[model samples]
Target: MSYSTLPRIPSGWSQSDSQASTSPVSPEEGVVQSVIKIPSTTYLGVESTVAPTPQFERNTADLTSNERAALLASSSSAVAGSAADAPDQWAWRDVGCEARTLGRLSAPITLAASLQILNILVPGMVLGRLGTDAIAASALAMSVASFSAAAPLIGLLSALDTLCSQAATGSSRPGLPGIYLQRCLLLCIASFIPSVILWWNIHPIFIYLRQDPVIAAMAAHYLRYVTFSLFFTLAFESIKKFFIAQGFHHAISLVQVLGTPITLASVYFLAVHPATSIGYVGIPASVAISYALSSLMAFAWLKTYGGSRGWTGLSWEAFRGWGRMARLAVPGAVMVSSEIVALDLLTVATSYLGPTALAAQAIVSMTIQSSGTLLMGLSAVTANRVGNLLGLAQPHRARNAATAALGCGTIVGIVLGVILYSLRGQWSYIFNPDPEVHAIVKRMIPLLASLLALTVITALSLGILRGQGRPKIGAYMNLASFYLVAAPVGFLTLRYTSMGIVGLWLSFFMAVLTSGLGQLVFLLRTNWYDQVLKCEARLAHDGHHEGLMTPENHPSA
Candidate 1:
């Protein structure tokens, strides 16, 4: 849809084209031309909204003349006979565009939180039909399945978030789409084998944990279904991240919502049926079907409502660049993988406490994981925004934006903590109505809430570092935090004290808090803003000196 055109600027605006056309286009041509020069005053507030509709909106209060000039020059291209040409420049009209951009990107976070909220009810439903042991097995299955799928691919998907956002703000280039698609395909292929192996072996692992062989066998069957579904899930996750970073998240959320009711029904029918009764297998089956439906739904939605004939080409050359992108993505995956492993290790600690404790811990962990959805969402936003700033060669603003995002994320996390804490008693009804499990969950709620803020800070810092193309920090931080801090705490406390599962939970909280604090300190100490400038400068120097990249080729080092 065409919006109103920008008004011609009289004082500061200058036409840069040498061959000026005499006549403007007709209405039939569907084009409008107008040049609006971005003043030096506006550049400082460039980080603010393009439109200051919100009270918190501020202009970019720190944009330099060079950046302002580049933006102004870019506006001329917007008027070069196509409304679709560089619509990003139109964002300048809002004056609060940056803030609005941040707000716009939050759609996925909210959606993801809502989805997690729905999953919280799963344990509750299962608790009524299956016993505590069954619930425990299911939880363990989820941890394993999630690790195989979500944890390993986080870096790859997250890279899409950062890179896509950067691509949006900058000029497009040849092979960009191919690179993204290749990366996605590669992730899909790589994720399959581990997922399959985990699916096949998870039951035996649980059996070795001394869980009931029956529950383990059933859980393994369910996990196999989940494993099969993971291929679709990972693809959907990759596409979701890619589109979200490109400022399109609403569709993914819609697909998720649309699939939820069906999934719930599937679980209920499969678990309770006379002939098809699969017991715990029903849960995994429902989850797998849900993901598959959602993936298909997401794909269909994108195809019909999104672009026609999207990403239909092959780029063999881009495959060579996978090593570089994977280099960046691996650290992020490792960082995420380590944290998940810590959480799983804590689960292992709770295993010694018996079925009731394990069931209680699983329920509580699910809730906590659900609550952290907002943190993950904010982290994604921070990564994308920071990456854009770095890509545009504005590191100071990137730092400031990262800082602001952290502040915002922290406040959100605190509020979520309060909400989750208040509802602790109520949450126990989801898995099983057992009084003992309820009591345990209620006691742990406060600790989880207290640690919520810290989780946000840690996640945001990870996002910042990852977006800054320093996934190595994320990897190292996770190693230090989980292996160095969280793991030892879990083992020592569980082994040496009578705290039992509570001790493990406490250690979990301590790990996140300590890790978050450490990440924050590291992030603050780093000169990332200066690093951005240096990167841009180095890229420019390399281009000028070595003739490896030209202005028309790419806007990168």
Candidate 2:
């Protein structure tokens, strides 16, 4: 029935564009907006509300420019108050718009992320040329570095996905994003010190864990050398996150372009060149120098072009939000690290399988790592999209962006899976010369290829959870999946039967399915509007109350 003939208005019906254009509308309300009151969550998720008034009060602070646009767009209510309800039924045009945006965003990130992988892969190649044992040691070190340093660093900074993206999008306060950046950087640096010490003294720990003594000694040495480089790596990552939050990532790509070649050249010169052949130590040293240089370049770019992004200068206020940020950061790290941690633990266990098996497992694991990190490019984009839209209180658009990310993830997974599958025989050659390693990797490649889509889905879903400020959900899900289901299945399959490394990869199918499908289902149940409320509540609690993000002077605002 027509709106004119309707007896009473429906709660969530959206008016058509023609009807909206012909009718009078309020700036504060939509063309045919809801008279129904917002169900309050009251200071995050405290949940207390009164009877709906004939007219309800709305906060002006929550009415950012984006919120105003969302209100105007509410003319199409089939999309309706269902924002927090489901992850489907988005307009085709909106999906196309988001896909185009995601494509453009993915370019710089994909380049940067691929270059980051090169820093890991090229070093392994350098080690491969040294010897089989050397390549095996390098793999062990890489796995250790992943969970010990890289995972924690990435996790701590994951909060930037939520805070910086929201601050950049929803707040008039430009410096707000930078404030969150500063806070995350501080936490990461603090976390790094303990990790450095652990690496320095890891020989005994590795021995205690029953790793091969010689390989453990070598891996321990690598971590110690790598520790010095990690600081610079941290610096580069911190600055890049700031760039990402602002949606300007060309600079990060540029830094990677310069940094990748320099890293590779240094690896060759220091490891292979007769003049400075430092043997094994050269690999870590080159990585150190490369990161230091890249960090400097990224910082320089931020200083010159960052004014528009709201980082006026560092403030003492950056010290205040430690508690608020950590709540997310710790979970973010857990969520991001859970799978990596599981794999690393498996890598540790693989040491018992002998050097050849260890080497083969490393190659396959590296192949998987490369694909997963590459997908991180898209994951980062998805996180930014969801966070920004939510900050504007545009739940419908946020939901749409999320669904769009999943679609993009599928396409990317298919393309990458094809490439990996096609390269199954020769792919391990890049990391090692051993015919045995190549054969093992070739065997595992099919299984790895099958997991590509699932990995992409999990990565994107985690990003969405991060953006939603519900990272702990992913952390919980991943921990349960990895420790409870996947790891047990893998260890039992490998030990009880003679399936070997193939069994290990086969076991991962459970982890992927458990976490991926679980997160996907949970995303369907998300209350998008409630998420918006939580975002605002978090910002007000952390950014506004602390007087760090907004331009206004009063601490009491």
lDDT of 2 at 219: 84
* lDDT for each candidate structure: 0.59, 0.72
lDDT of residue 399 for candidate 1: 57
lDDT score, candidate 2, position 552: 30
Over all chains combined, what TM-score does candidate 2 have? Answer: 0.82
For 97-175, candidate 2 gives per-residue lDDT tens digits of: 6566566667878978887788778777778888877778878987888898888788888888888877765554657
Off by over 4 Å in 2: 1-89, 545-557
Model 1 C-alpha lDDT per residue in residues 1-557, reported as the tens digit of each score: 12222222122222222113223323332222322111111222232112222221222122212122222112222112211123243333232333444555566557765765565476346644578767776776777766666567655566665555444333224235335656655865776676687678776678777867866776677677666556665666676665554444566667767777877787778776668767767766676777777777876765676552124356665456566566667777787777877777677667667777888888777766766555676677677777665555444456556666676677777887788778886977766788988888888878887877567777878888867767777788788877777778878887788877777777777777777777787786765423443333322321232211213233221
What would you estimate as the lDDT of candidate 1? 0.59
Candidate 1 lowest-lDDT run of ten: 34-43
* TM-scores for candidates 1 onward, in order: 0.76, 0.82
Off by over 4 Å in 1: 1-100, 147-150, 174-178, 202-204, 272-277, 308-312, 528-557
Question: Which one is best on TM-score?
Answer: 2
